[model samples]
Target: MSATRRQVLARTGAVAGIAFTGSLTELFAGTAAAKGMGRAGYGPLVPDPKGLLDLPKGFRYRVLSREGDRMLSGEGEVPSNHDGMAAFGGRRGQVHLVRNHENRTDAEIRVPAVRGLTYDPEGLGGCTALTLDSANRVLGERVAIAGTSTNCAGGPTPWGTWLTCEETEDKAGTNGYTKDHGFIFEVDPTNPHRTGAVPLKAMGRFQHEAVAIDPRNGVVYETEDAFERPFGLFYRFLPVKPRGGLGSLRAGGSLQAMRVPGVPDLSAIQETGAAFDRVEWVDVPDPLAAETPIRFQDFGPKGITHAQKLEGCYWGGSSVYFVSSFARSNEGSAADHYGQIWRYDPARRRLTLVVVFGPDTDVQLPGEEPDNICLAPSGGLMVAEDGEGAQHVFGVTTRGEVYPMARGRQNIGTPEEPAWGEFAGICFSPDYDTMFVNCYTPGTTFAVTGPWHR
Candidate 1:
């Protein structure tokens, strides 16, 4: 733990070019000037003069939206706890950013109720849409959907839409909520003025975390964020009508939980290089688990295998990569891993461990509790850290070497008080000229543009 940033990289065999800035603020600044940074990443992050986000030299970010900003619709101020997000290209050099507000009924600000469009009038979680020009300047922002619960991390559809997932299984009539809460709601970024909110109940009603779609067949892969007894199961939805777009998902798709051929439980994956038998899909009878949690059902341990804390997932290179954050032997799980990155190939029906983090007490980057992930166009991956240390967006090379990418530099209390919050929703703009990410507190969305290795 006493090793400097440079010493840590040298000690852990992490990617080179990571500079040691005594403070996290100067992180990427020295990285850019470092000799060994190579072409794999945008050298060390440069501290923001305004003290918001630290990036590499020549990289800059503009604050596109904040938690309490005034909404264009004038209904209510922007909600807090911004979570997952996606950016889409728009006409006239503009981009549409769809964001998730991970609020509970107790959140500081609500998305405001709009009568028929709200699922729970007391719930304050939902998605919002913001328009950004080529310069990454906000043109306008408005509430896309509201009256939901715990709108966590969802995924972007191939057909240009955002799927916002709820991370809670709070039953209706409880906690002042009148309707069942766990569901995936689709938001059209191009137009947020939809008539009513459409919850994809066919996608299963577990504590959903994030989702990724297989472009080859439009199969939607979902990750559950549950961590209590029984854990969470990775799920897939096969739209009855293939390639029918969101309409087909609404038409009702068959839900299936992922399982290993003969391994009846998750205990099979306790080692670093553990590889599972070929994957098998088990039918989930009720997608809307009105009673029992879908993960604790018979299919969970008997038919479908489960993992501890499955968080973010991304579809890239003909495979789906996902994360299992903060697992420990004491938790009664199979392994004692700080973080685990798994790769699932549908074509080959295989799931392999691509990256295994931790054996250190310091909670290193690149392997620290990886949350939302995005495959960089520059031949690597960007993973947001939600671990116990100073949070950072880590860059992992194709070879598994991890480096610090960016850090939170916002000053929330005093000039010396740095708000080190988790980074979520790391994504690239459709044009690849900008990277959009969220600082999960006093919520802030940043559009970072720099000399990225496209």
Candidate 2:
């Protein structure tokens, strides 16, 4: 069967089930076995090798908190469709986590807003702040703040702030209060008073999925999350001052979309190293003008457009890595499409194909849908798989080693039988010892850690 066809079948057959027995054992033995695990190699951390929520020999996971759970702020409970998250150091012995709820006005997660912020009070699309202990246990939870729409995926600022992004462009009716639906909002875990919810209009409005801030230079790199038709664009926001702070982003800056010069079409140059591939930055006259900052429209040799459905982006070392979740490959092009990872080196001002998916002899997982991504502290990239079949959290190392980290196991409302699938939002704690994963459809987050062995 074709990859795309197989993916469709896999999605239909995917089931959600809960593994209670094995999970208990893995949790207790995980910590003790870590010391002797030997350099902590990388491999599938899920206990069930056949495919389930269960972890491996010495690993276990506990749901920190699920949507619709009450918070300490007197706010009712969390909504569903949780997405990207940021972890911060709290004042006491707790750590603060700012999580995003990717819900629309029609399906809101009602929560009282932090003073000065306005919320639907019945919408699920908002942000939450929760405190956790060292072992990844939830100590307390708060609304943190509310009043947003389709809060998809965003990045963390160096100034210890979370920039939650809205992923939609539907700005009519109740959602029309905002200038545009595509903008970044700043949230402060330390001081909720100073950091109320507000969109940063200076950042050109687009279908933003994730943002990556340059610590050295306050440049904000953004990626769009659209895969329907023409696809989306990749953008970079440069503050007026070369070394300005995060606050400067609010003042305004030059917003530019990326275009590969000489490569009118990405598919043509897919195989060409394309050395440097002169990048052109188009200026945005008015960020809120519903105008795209990109001037050039082209694709490379592989039939991959210059910026096609740019999903997750992150800054590593001196370069920025972004993923195109729907780029075509050299092998049999599936209907749904395979994805590719590209790196833009600031020093060289060039774009390089770091990894290409589909028809690979190595990791032969079918389907090509990719989502949010993060750098694994252990020296590799962890990507959330959004493809068909059991969605999985995959880890690709710098050496091109692919490992499945976790799988989604949900209860399909049937006592006689349950289902199991894949998961997204694969992130590591500040110490990198503990890993947190977000399950999309079921809308749950799990903390996984233990003696890890490749």
Candidate 3:
């Protein structure tokens, strides 16, 4: 298995979004902490003798599922390229996880195209639902939704569902696909009967990376992972039904793209403390991308803002946070940087620059293109790194300290050419006791437990 950032970026595109009050670098610079404190983390990592994963002294991980392992449903082997995921509490104290399989038509192990759960018979990427006991053991695993192409990352709904986003813009006849590929599908964790194979067409069609839903208003904030010239745009969805309960998203919705007045590109803002006070949104002329994608659609003279590789977004308090992996001047972005994390306060309509990974940093450091991020249970944030050389899952503290949480040691490649996998789906159980994450390559799910609050 190859690197997902490289694999996804090769066949398609990538990007990120979000905002905060100030820059992490600037905050630490003004304080006593180091800019990128590698030692301030949960102590030094204790290497794994099994050569699987390395963690801090007291932390440990257990492999829950693997790519080739037969699922309890007996439908097929677990699919390849495990990406974004979310966990929910079920009846009888069981925990349910809806996992995404980012496989295209050519992948070897595709999510089992089960009878009632499949959306497209010809498409090869979709999602799977895993049930685990409180003890952190797999109870059952089956196809949640299938027949969709490139199901990369998705967001959890306020009413208990997963909005699986397709990170592609492939057309119906282009690749033997029966239906247009770039759309969002809803997956129910507790009840598969509620998760029929239906596409939320009103959510807009494009190269979607992930979505973050606001609990107060049911407004869904989406990120696009498109790589073509202008890159991708961050979108906001207003559901007509508005968080009434489960399945409200299917009712219908209006989609709009975020526009920052005179700013055409997100990478143009180099300062960490820069802010967009009067944020504006423009209605997407073509939500379905019938001819042009949402990012390419015209937004009039003011124009919409674009970012390179908008990867993930999740809710933290009142703000919806997002990530922009990396930008290169040669790649059509305004400036180059390792990564950036932003916070969007929807209520106040403010976009603030919280943390920025400087352009001139070590490629092997913690700040290299942060991917799927989650607000830590303890107080700060947990960021998954999709950078080069050494791959690690880093923790950013409230004091603006960067620390290595876990490192990948699994050499999926041969002895001569070694390859380390990047972590994805960094989500915790409903109880906040065990963290459930996936190793993209070789497709492994881990249940990590330790002194997370410490």
Which number leads on TM-score?
3
TM-score-better candidate, 1 vs 3: 3
Two-way lDDT contest, 1 vs 2, winner: 1
Model 3 Cα lDDT, one tens digit per residue, 288-325: 99998778788998888999999988776678878898
lDDT of 2 by residue, 1-454 (tens): 2434433434443222211111111111223221222232343343454333655456777778776667666767766777888777755556778888787765645445556664444444767777788877787777655767778789888888888887876553545444346678888766665667667877866677898887888888988775444556677898776565545567777877676765533433443233555676665555664444222233333232345557788776677777777654332222333566677887677887655555343233443556777666555556776765445665554444455555565643344433433465566666667777777555677778874333
- Candidate with the larger lDDT of 2 and 3: 3
Per-residue alpha-carbon lDDT of model 1 for 312-397, expressed as tens digits?
Answer: 88776577877787666677676666667777888889877756655343433334456887766454567886754356788765
TM-score for each candidate, following the candidate numbering:
0.87, 0.80, 0.90
Off by over 4 Å in 1: 1-38, 262-273, 359-366, 411-419
Worst 10 residues of 2 by lDDT: 18-27
TM-score of candidate 3 against the unseen true structure: 0.90
- The local distance difference test score of each candidate is 0.75, 0.62, 0.80
